[model samples]
Each structure stands twice: as C-alpha cells, then as structure tokens.
Target chain A: MVTINKPATKLNEPSKPQKSSSPSLTAFVKAFKNSIVLIVFILLWELAPQLGFVEKTFLPPFSEVVQAWWELLVTGELWRHFEASILRSLFGFLLALALAIPLGLIIGWYPLARDLLTPILELFRNTAALALLPVFILILGIGEVSKISIVLFACTWPVLLNTISAVKNVDPLLIKSARSMNISSFKLFYKVILPASVPTIFTGIRMAGTGAILVLIAAEMIGAKAGLGYFITYSQYNFLIPEMYAGIITISLLGLLINYGLSSAERYFSRWKQ
Target chain B: MDKIKFERVTKKFLVRDEYKKGAQREFTAIKDIEFSVKEGEFITLVGPSGCGKSTLLDLLTGLTQPTKGRILIDGREITGPGLDRGIVFQQYALFPWKTARGNIEFGLEAKGIPKSERKEKAEYYLDLVGLKNFADRYPHELSGGMKQRVAIARSLAFNPDVLLMDEPFAALDAQTRETLQTELLRIWKKTGKTIIFITHGIDEAVYLGERVVVLSANPGTVKKIVDIPLKDRLEDADIKSNPAFINARREVWNLLHEPEFQGAHI
Candidate 1:
C-alpha cells in the first residue's frame, strides 16, 4: 500500500473533545450579542406609548398586544384561525407544486411545448394575482375555491419559471459525461438532471411558499368569516386595536415560521453542496 | 487483431466566422487520420493545442460522428457510446453530489448491478486508487489530485476494454503530475487495459507511453510515431534523466518544431 503523506495543517485535523463547560456559556453570550438589536427594538416599542410618544388607544404598547395575544391563545380562538390559514396556504402551495414541477420539466425539455406555452405564461405571470381576486370570486363564487385559486395563481409562476430555467441550464459537461457512459435518456434525467437542478428548484419552491402566504392572507381579508386577515380587519373596524396588533404580529410570526421550515428543508436536501 | 482501428477517418465542423456574418465556414478538425492501437497497448497522442486530439477521443468514444470514413473496435463499427470504452475528462466530470464510492459505482448502477455487488465493487476500486478511507467524502472535500484519483477510479471501476484519457493530468502541479503518471503506469500494468492518453506535454507523453503519436496542427494528421524502447523505465525513479529517455524526448521535440509545424503555434 502506498502511503501518501499529506501536509500537516490544523484545518484538516479533527475537532478535539471539549473538556470545559465554558464554551457553551460563551456561545450563549454570543447568541445574545447577535440578537441585541432586536431586544433593544422591543424595549423601545414597549416604552414608546408609556412615554406618551403615541396614544395607547391608537398604537397600543407592545405589552398590550402580547396580553391580547395571550387572551386569544387561552380561549383557543387564535388556533382555529391559524389552522384555517395554514391549511389554505399549504394545500394551495402543494397543489401548485404538483402541477408546476411536471409542466416545467416538460416545457424546459421540449422546444415545442416552450414555443406553444411561453407567450401565454409570460402574459399570466405579468398579471398580478390580487388583480384576479374579483374575477376568481365571480368564477368560483367566493368560497374556499376562490381563496385557494388566488394562492395557487400567485405561487405557480415563480415555481414554474424557476424549474424551467433550472432544467434548461443543467451543465452540458454533466450530460456529456453521463452520455459517454451509455446511460439511458430516462436514467440521465432522473439521476443527473434532477439532482443537479435541485438547489435552484428549492429556491423557486421557497419563493412560492412565501408568495402563497401573502396571496392567501389577502384573499382571506376579502369576504371571509375566519382567518388571521379577517380577524385583523374585523378587530380594527370594532376599535379593538390591541387585537388587531396581535393579528398582525401573528401573521408576521407565521411568515417567519414558514421561511424557517423551507430553509431547513433546503439545507437537508442540499447537504452535499457544502 | 488491433483493439482499435481508424480507417481514413475525417471530421469537419460548421462554424460561424466572426468577421463575416451569415456565412458558415467548414472547418476541418482532423483529416485522413489513420492509426491502430493494439490490445493492452499504452499509446499517447501529442500535439499542439488545436490539433484535434480531443476531437479524436470524442470520435473514439462515439460522442461525435466522423464526417467521412469509419472507426472500428475489434473490426466492428462504432455507432455510439457503449460499455466497451471508458473516458476520463480533464475537468474530472465527477458528480458533485456523490461521494467517492458513489461516483465510482455510477456505471455499475447503469448496468443494473445489485446494490450489494455495486458497493463491493466500488469499495474495491476506491482501495485500488488508494482512497479507501475517503469513500464517504464528497468531491468538494477532496483535493485536486484526490479528485482526479477518484475520477480515475471511477473510470476503471466500469472495467471497459479501452480507456480514453483526454489530458487527464494537465491541471495538476508538477509534483502531483509525476506521482499520478507513475500511479497510472502501475494501474495500466496491473489491469492490462488498452489506454489512449492525449496530452500536449512532450515529457509526459514520453514518460507514460510505449509509442507517442505526434500530430501536425492545421487539419490534424499524424506527423510521426516515435517508440520509446525503455522497457522497465517505470521501475526507475530517475528515468527522466536517463540517456534513452532524453534522446526520445529530443526526437519528439524536434518533430514538433519543424517548419511545417511552426505556423500552428500561437
């Protein structure tokens, strides 16, 4: 056996076992340092109304919003609306994914499909999803279908266009290499093309997820009985400012949670990239 | 019988001339090329940059069609890429997503080898390349030499009759190149598979090949074929400084600098 001696460098050395508990303490302190700006912002928000910089009835202090959020949580009313919104967004997003991915692959792979569908796609992609809300309500009768269709419309373009571009732009060298191996065309697509296009596809899926939430909330606000969007709008009309703030905060938190979930999935799928 | 035969093979490409729009020009990459490689022979094709060395390999692999004439392996015409020949590209075209063993198992998987057998074969080849411990490491995690080694292991794992290498060591440092050259000779001797290595380096061609086929540039054609007769050169550490090795190197160098070969140099 030939023994090839590599250079001695700390970079390649395996990590040593930690003998002290001090490192975890230091890491906790470092995390706090990173979040210092957010902490200060929350503190300033809490003090602004108490200092009379704004009227409490109009803007309400951060603490009052939290209290309203807690009361809603205790009564379990928020959970119902949250579950409804989550289900609508997820169902629409998944449906869009199922339709868009296969169509995108087809359009990207064959020039005939691209030539026939490109102009139509461009036209629909340019039109805003919210602009179609009234048309969808007219066509689908303002029920769950209209709301779901709005989310689907908003989410589809990004996922479809990105998948098309990803499939079209796979490295020619990779295809050449695989072809030289005498692999079948079907095997080439599944083994080489799909894996290679995954990172870019994930980018599109994450964008579609964000788009689904935004369109769903806007759709929910229009003639809806139960949703975070309806709750915020209804509370504002009833002069329950703290409840309105709580609803807005909930929506923001929901967006953050969706983003975190998508990013984690992206990381798991693309672990080989690093 | 010769393992590979090229009978009056010619290749032409249609290229758009940059200076004149709407005019397509026919550029001859190689013309009337005739050569044959014996089974288990180590042959090197050496030339200047645009001498169609890579195009020749492409034709051999059946990746591209010859404009005229035909190439035969074991007296049968090569229609397209098949399992009989394997190739190692300069870029090391390993799938970045796969680990070392996974990349090596790619061809076997294509052949419908079962998972257990594929794993065993992949491990065997990885060990042959001296990367047994690196089986689980991805391409990005390996160094340049390690990556090339993995690529070599991958090609060899498929057990093809002929191995076509296109300047496979040109990107490495001098030290690593020398090490790999020796390792390749060892592998070639062990496996006894026909190897057709393409390179521009005169010394590298002489060091590894039994016979070096030198091609002239404009419309690439064989200029000369020089035989290096040192039988046990790979066993010598200082073969480069040996007298016969120097004389063969000088001979090939003189052929490349001939007046007819001068204008092709940029």
Candidate 2:
C-alpha cells in the first residue's frame, strides 16, 4: 500500500495528512530510482577518458563537454546556430501542417479526391526527402528556402498520411447519430468528424515534429553558414571535438523539448480517452 | 390522425455473390413494411435477428431511403431526416468529446437555438433522464447505463415529437434494462412524445409498449400486432409479474416461433 502511494505521490500534491514530509521524501526516492540508469551512464561518460579506458582527444570527459557547451553559450555562437535551425524547422513544420491537414481531410472525406491524389501521393511518399535534397538545392539554391523545403518535404508525409487515415477511420456510428438530427454536412464534419479524428491526427503531428528536426539537421549539415548541424560539421572540420559534442547535445535537448511539447498537447486534446 | 406512417416500405440491397466472382445479387431486407402510430402512442417492434428491425428504424430516422414506398411524419412526407424526429441507437452513440450536457445541446445548437435556451433545455432533459449530476461527465467517464441515459437526454433535448429507438436497452444487464424500462415509460407519460422501440426481448416488448408489432424474417414483414391492456401499469403493481404481461409475452413468443422464421429464439 505504501509502495503504491509512493509512485502516485509524484503526480499528486502534498495534501495527505498521514505523512506530509514522507511524501516528498518518497517522491525524491522514486525519481532517483527511475533515473538511476541515466545517472550511471553520465558517470561513466565523465570517467571513461580520465581512467584511460578511451583516448582523451577522441572522447573527452562529460565535464569537459559541459564546459565547452558553457563557453560556446557565453560567446553567443550557440544561440546564432540554435536560432537559425529553430526558425527553419518551425516554418517548415507549420507550412506542412497548414497544407497537409486540409488536403488530407478532403482526400479522406471524398472518395473522388482520394482516388485522384493517392497515386501521386504514394509515388512521392516512397521517395526519400534526403534523396531530393540535391534537386531542391539545384532548383531552390543552397539558401534558407532549400533547407526549409527539405524539412517541409520530410514532415509532410506523416502529417498528410496520418490525417487522411484519421478522418477515414472515424466511427461510422457517430456520423449516423449526428446525421439523424438533420445536421448539415459542414456541421457533421466540424462537430463529429474533426473531434473524432483529433487523437489520430495528433499522432501524425508528433511524427512530423520529429521529422522536422532530423531532416533540417541533415539539410544544414549539407550546406549552411549557421545552424546546429553546420556548427557540428564546422567543429569536426576544426578538430574541436568537445564543441562538436556540444552541438550534438544541443540537437538532442531540442528534440526532447519538441517531443515533450507534442506529448503534452496530445494529452490535453485526448484527456477524455481514459 | 396518425403521428407517423410507413406506407409499403421495402428496402433492398445489392451484394456481391460469394460463389460467383464479380457477380452482384439483389437482396430484399424488408418488404412492404406498413404501419402507423397515433400521436403520443408507445409501440415496440420485436423480431428475430434477420427481421430488419434496425433497418426499419433507420428508414424511420431517414438515415436511409426506402427502395419503394415512403415514410410520413405528421402527414408530411419525410424526404430526409428532420428535427420532427429523434433516434436512439443500441450503442449509446454519445460523442466521447462532449459531456452529457454538451451532447444534449448538440441538436439544439444545430436547430439554431440560442445558447442560453439550449443550456436550459439541456439541463431540463439531463434532469429528465436523472443524469443532472453527471451533466459534466464525458461519455467514457459514465457507466453503460449512465451513457445510455445521456443518449436519451440528448435525443429528447431537441423536443422532437417522434422518438425512434433501436434496441436502446439491448446491451444492458437485466436489472438496468428493467430500471430504464420503468424510467422510459414514466418519461413517455410525462412528455407525451410518440415512441417506436425495436427489441429482440419478448419481455421487454411486453413491458414497454402499449402495442407490440411482431415481425417475421426472410424478407422481413409484420406478422402480428399485439395490444397490451394493463389495469395497473408500473404505478401500482409489479407489471412484469402481472398475468396480462405474461400472456402478451407468450403470444409474441408463439408468433415468432411459428416455424417460418429463423433464429426466433434470439
């Protein structure tokens, strides 16, 4: 009983009168227990180079990487790269979302639209975004347009496909029930279909979020004056290994933040799903 | 005058023949389904599994058009579903995203009722179905019986004169089914709304309806319409235990079991 209460205390406020102080203590212990593996991995990362398990130049200690990250942060160099990547991914992801959702809804709702577009969609969906980067660079040039377009291309498929399936898969009984009240087609779509498809559409959006980050990183690595991907490549060229690790760490943290944001949004939208 | 009428309604479906590749066959679900309901009357439809009981309700709701003949409501032809009628399906059909009150407000909103009036009417029906306390609860948060109650409140909220229910309590346990039956009768008396309920349960048909319309299968059509005359209905006696109730149940049972209909035990 106490063990069950301990895990739940992590979520709930400290309101129980039986052991107010113990709840916090239990929460801390639970959190510690959960992250013990992560703590050990971090410890090993810090110690391996110092203990001569690996060469210092190849893999610096975790502290040295953290120090490098702080130095880059203070110099404001990291922020410039971070800002460039953030803007590109954000614009690309938003564009894909704006275009894909409406198109997907139409295609899913109307069989004629689905039949007309599905063949073309499937042809492009199978073509990798990275493979099209060179063509995009040649057509759009090695500018912000090209980098953003690559992210847009990669992100579009997940959102579009997921949205299409989401709309198509809404329970037919819901539609029947709504229509029985003489609801208009527009009302049926907005009131019934849209809300019913939310959770599935969110699944697509999250996948697109991840794709936006990864594809933008790859595009930046290919050609960019400033961005986290470019910074890492530049650091590698100059043998600034710690700084390279720092850029990699920044990308990882950014991915975590985006994933965390999407999951929270999904939770809020689907709160009724038990 | 009859509140609702079904004039020689026949529904047909085209299906691919299982044995013959790419071949289509015509199947008749119900033939010449003719009936009439007086204003404020309560009627129950009972039939075996393939008797097109659900198909009949769908036609009445205007979810589907009859292949032949037509349905009428208030002496006007029903070209499509209108606010004059409401339907309750076997599944609660409450929107998971909407709370009990929100679901009740849906049809009213569609009917262009003002927000305040919609809220008032939703509250009234929520209270009518004994789900006032659960007005804020989502469909998934409610129990099976509670969800069905919310569904009833939602349909009733729009003030439709005719309510068509397709086995609305078929999914509940016997206790909840009986309880909802009593509640339904009480609401019918209070609101004076005409109801056409479809069910497989003979006891349920006898208990709920003023008249039970028993149907035969294999191209479904009406077989018998049994009138139930109870001296003490729900208010004064255990109606199910009454002799009239037993006799009505047995009569419907005998009609369904007359060797022509298949799966009559259902």
Per-residue accuracy of model 2 over B1-266 as CA lDDT, tens digit each:
99988899999999899989999999899999998999999999999888898788888888789999998898888888888888898998889999889999998997889998998999899899998788888888788899999889888888899898989998999889888988999899999999999998898898888999999987889988999997557675577778888888889989988878645545
TM-score of 1: 0.94
Which model scores highest in DockQ? 1
**B67-110 in candidate 1: lDDT tens per residue?**
99999999999999987898898989999899998899998887
- Lowest summed lDDT across 10 adjacent residues in model 2 chain B is found at B257-266
State the lDDT of candidate 1 residue by residue for A135-168, as single tens digits. 9999998788888888888889988888888888
User: What DockQ, on C-alphas, does every prediction get?
Assistant: 0.75, 0.64
Model 1 preserves the real interface contacts to a fraction of 0.74
